[model samples]
Target: MPDDFSWSDFIQRALPLAILGLALIGAPLLIFEPEGLPRMRSLSKELAQVRAENAELTRDVSKLRAEVRELRDDPAAVERIARGKLGLVRKSEVVFQFGKPR
Candidate 1:
């Protein structure tokens, strides 16, 4: 009811155009901008790191499996490991060591 304001004019003339402009702006944001922007790049970086770690873990698993197979089927490998790691020897053999001066 002020001198320059008209509620009837706003409802009849401005509201529909305002709604149309908002829809025009919002439609592209909802459709293309979401898919073509930040989330895809973030997910791509995460996927690359996961693939690299998966390859390293796969190689580790393969090596462990080969060692396990050898330990299961090879007695000579087990004896070599015991001799090197545990310092084991036959009852008649003696081990001698000499010390180095600092």
Candidate 2:
């Protein structure tokens, strides 16, 4: 048994260094590892963006479904799209010509 260095003193001195070494190892794992905290945060942001995009796509699908239903079931809907988008007119309708100013 050593006179100056006891078991209690060795434990006290080595405990803080051991803890610090563990903390140093753990910090790199937390910040830089592939499946670490930083990756989890990145995945969280990606998940939010995907959710928002999914919501927007859902809304667009709903709108398209409604438009499809209207165009399929309503003659007026077809006529409105034709007249507005295709510049179509019936045989008996008068046509007007407008010119842009130079």
Candidate 3:
């Protein structure tokens, strides 16, 4: 209300409030800028990929554990693996070999 008031005085009083307002509005925009958004999206995609890989690894581990349990509890599994992988036959079984004609 004083007649001696000037524009500089008004500016001095309002500068702190102006800075506070700009900080409040700009901080979030700065954090969510174009570059920041893409970086966040990339990170989210990588996290999802890692989760999928972890799930696949977990399934593989479970399958291996089940195979181990089957081999420990059942002798048939070992025989099957030997016959299929190693081509082993019983002692009395006849083995035949076939060759392609030249």
Candidate 4:
């Protein structure tokens, strides 16, 4: 509106603000675009896998605890383990072998 308001003056006044606005808009992309998003996705997948493995291990531990309790409190369970794992027989029982000859 004034005679002294020239193109140079307009550029001088607008350049710094334009630069600042562009920096504000572009800083995040510059900082995060290359690696941050992909790394976050990778870490999220790893966390999910770890949680799944942890749940499976927790189930295994519970099963083992139940087996331990059964083996401790139930004579039948102990006898089964002994016969199946240790090949033990009662004193009154006779052993038999019917396998093919080696």
Ranking by TM-score: 4, 3, 2, 1
Q: Model 4, stretches more than 4 Å misplaced?
A: 1-27, 99-102
Better of 2 and 3 by TM-score: 3
lDDT, residue 66, candidate 3: 100
Candidate 4's residue-wise lDDT over 11-82, tens digit each?
999999999999998888866885777778888999999999999999999999999999899999999999
Q: Would you list the C-alpha lDDT of every candidate in the order shown?
A: 0.89, 0.95, 0.95, 0.93
Instruction: State the lDDT of candidate 2 residue by residue for 1-102, as single tens digits.
Output: 667978888999999999999999999877888888778999999999999999999999999999999999999999999999999999999998999989
lDDT of each residue in 1-102, candidate 3, tens digit only: 789989998999999999999999998898799768778899999999999999999999999999999999999999999999999998999999999999
Candidate 4: 10-residue stretch with minimal lDDT:
30-39
Q: Quote the lDDT for 52 in model 4.
A: 100
Off by over 4 Å in 1: 1-24, 27-36
**Residue 19's C-alpha lDDT in candidate 4?**
100
lDDT, residue 35, candidate 1 = 71
